[model samples]
Target: MSVEHDKALAAKGRHIALVIAATMLGWLAMSLFIGPALGLAGRYALLFDFAALAGFIYAAVNIFQLWRMRQDSQR
Candidate 1:
């Protein structure tokens, strides 16, 4: 790929990372405050935690993919 294309991809990756960070923060807020305020039970709260975990895993995968792409571009 051309340098310009690689740069575009890197920019996209940064945007995705920002989005993921925001989503994770939202999930954290929901799990910590919203759920309790809504009178959610432990099980329900646990579900929110699970959702956050999934988001974290997804974010990690996305970051890894971006890193790989950067490395490939360097070669």
Candidate 2:
């Protein structure tokens, strides 16, 4: 029972961390790239590149999370 609870807590914590990380990345991209490219005033400079970076970051995080979950479950 305790183990199950611990696992759930760990999973939730990881999920929240990932969510925050993604959100922060998105905001950074918007501020530094998307907004500028769109001429939206809130721009920085890395538009298309930012988009690519965002996608890659998301994919990497998912892969890492999947690996983590798999290892945790094996235990």
For each candidate, give its TM-score against the true structure.
0.78, 0.51
Clashing residue pair totals per candidate (backbone < 3 A): 0, 1
Top candidate (TM-score): 1
Residue range 1-75, candidate 2, lDDT tens digits: 368756975786677567657766776777776676788742344454466566667757776766686677768
lDDT for model 2 comes to 0.66
Report lDDT per candidate: 0.81, 0.66
Residue range 1-75, candidate 1, lDDT tens digits: 897877888787887778788878888788888888998888987787778788778878878778787788778
CA shift at 3, candidate 2, in angstroms? 1.1
TM-score of candidate 1 on Cα atoms, chains taken together: 0.78
Cα RMSD (angstroms) for every candidate in the order listed: 2.0, 5.8
Candidate 1: stretches off by over 4 Å: 1-3
Which residue window of length 10 is worst by lDDT in model 2? 41-50
Relative to the true structure, candidate 2 reaches a TM of: 0.51
